[model samples]
Target: MPKKTDRHRPEPTSHTEPDLAKAKAVSIACGRRRFLIGLGALASAPLWPALRSAEAKAPAAAHWPGYADAMVIDALGGPGEYAAEPYAALSDKALADVRASGLSAVNVTVSGVGSYAKNPDETIRNIAYWNAQIAAHPDRLMLVRTAEQLALAKASGRLGLIYGFQDATPIGEDLDQVERFDQFGVRVFQLTYNRRNLVGDGCLEPGNAGLSRFGYALVEKLNEQRLLIDLAHGGERTTREAIARSNGPVAISHTGCAALAALPRNKTDTELRELAAKGGVAGIYLMPFLRIKGQPTADDLIAHIEHAINVCGEDHVGIGSDGTLSPIDFNDEFRRKHAADVADRRARGISAPGEEPDVYTFLPDLNSADRLDTLAGLLARRGHSDARIAKILGGNFARLFATAWSPA
Candidate 1:
């Protein structure tokens, strides 16, 4: 990753760095310069001194009291206003609802892997786009790089957003690109999407080839930079090998338990056990993969979480809801757009097994901004202790981030 530097210093040299000057003349023409500026400004912000919130120690309320104090995080998700285009600026109401979600931080996927899999330039632009979003709403959003910032965000009531990649394509063939992205405030990278990449085989790959030599090198590079490695969509063998090879804890940022759902996107019991044994985290996603058919309810989600906790232990399990904070509108237009997007992914051979046009992503039962809090209430009623609930909500991921991104 890019070494820490003084804010006044010129940015380091890279493939894109030399072109930054040329980018300025055409800033109005293409917005590349603006992206560079946004990324620099966001990444250069001071790191918060490590600290803890007293809210965590406060007495629990009769009904879902720990949520206000707990550092709720979505390991893999988005800030949604349901824009037609990707990375479009969120709407005012969307921003309001995002705050209402009561989440301390969210690891948002800035780069996609399906269609844009091999497009490094698009990944760079996506990072810049999110930086601009954070810049535009500085009061409501802050770029996160450490656990201290997560605590600070919760204490101050601002949403902390962490940049992440759902695939390693953004880094291209060169390992130095990993450092380039780290300079842009990206902290998490998944080895592959649902299909094969240069790094490794994805879950959908029939061959189930393990991590490539490049994949191993990339894991080492990520460890050297203290960036979190994610194996969410990796093939079973690839997931095992990467987890065993990584020097530090990795994440399955968003997935379901195969024992419960038996889907390609879901991790097997052995994968979950291996992850927990290595101090890693397994984030149970709130997606259609949690079930075999029809819509998955809050009960289904709770069952998956419970099963994960049983297999991986509570400290190694958390939520990485693949859904957005803003509730989806099931209006006719949204349905049409959803169908088209699913079709496109299917055409590209990137869509997962459970991704049907009618199967909505988010749980209709927990379909509000305050879904996490609602989840905590449900867990609490189910006899889960406040401590366990807190860990599942966000503590585990926070601990993982602190451990993996330390000495930064």
Candidate 2:
């Protein structure tokens, strides 16, 4: 197995830096130089064909419209609590592993509860790290904030990096930080993690008070910024309230439907319907808690997706593996040590009227993280049309992005 290392950290060299410095220096030398150059370019129009050809030369396989993934964690490699290897350290084999999974894009959540820095310099360094990794694979990866950008990345045979936050705590008590992140190309924002924050309560909170006043304001601001709101770890009331309150679609980036596996983390049929009714997508997660007890087969996951589709319709269904790069078995000692911290908030309260029995173990055949390809193949065998399968696989997510992200 690959091990994590800091040596693979991304850093910009003089060669790769954008020409901002040069532009600034030239501006001091002559203000009219840049403006005249722009006017001259408009007059000549010679560069238009080159730009068009460059776009046209993008790989054809990359242009598959229905090919988009809702959520994919960088577990085998990438920055996260679960991963052993840094994203930049990934070898060609690792990259191939992702491509082989049939994923055209992934939302890489770089900021999480543990990733926040106390000092400004450290924050800058962390942001720089992410930018460098993105620059390293410009042909294979591109930062995307809107649906159009994702399509462009797909057309270019590049993985789309939808920078996301797993916790709003990092934004601290200030809404300015959220605005700042929006400006920085963050496309998705989760209001809370597993614990309560200033904005709202998490799923683990004993009382599900829904959104706080600040939380409501945050939602409006997020909407104004055109960022996709995610209710992954939010409490039930909070999730529902957010869906009701938002002007645009919201996402449960990685989760299961309660109808399949009764868990606090899973959405009820009603919630799923509401989400889809509002033009949102519900990502069917592959986490252990999301599956039925015992080793969950790939079929088990498909069942959940199928159920969600029945309730939410085709355009509202997608995949969110919630996969981690962590090598420790979920049953290992480390998990036990963290057991109290990992308790499901939904599990604490009296079971809802129709909650299914809790599942402690997972399916045998779907034990590992590399079974996405198998799942896709299974979907094909189940008589799902290519177009429908494509939506379930990634198209639904693409549509959601089109609605949520706005460059204007």
Candidate lDDT (C-alpha), each: 0.78, 0.59
For candidate 2, list the clashing residue pairs, or say none.
Answer: 4-84, 68-394, 75-325, 82-326, 294-362, 295-362, 295-363, 295-364, 296-362, 296-363
Q: For residues 251-370, what per-residue lDDT tens digits would candidate 1 score against the true structure?
A: 999998887777799999899999999899988887878777666656677778888887888899999998778887656687688778789888988899988887667665566788
In model 2, state the lDDT of residue 28.
35
Off by over 4 Å in 1: 1-63, 115-118
Candidate 2's TM-score: 0.69
Candidate 2 segments exceeding 4 Å error = 1-88, 114-126, 324-371
User: Estimated TM-score per prediction?
Assistant: 0.83, 0.69
Worst 10 residues of 2 by lDDT: 1-10
lDDT of 2 by residue, 14-52 (tens): 442335654354333332222222332232124434423
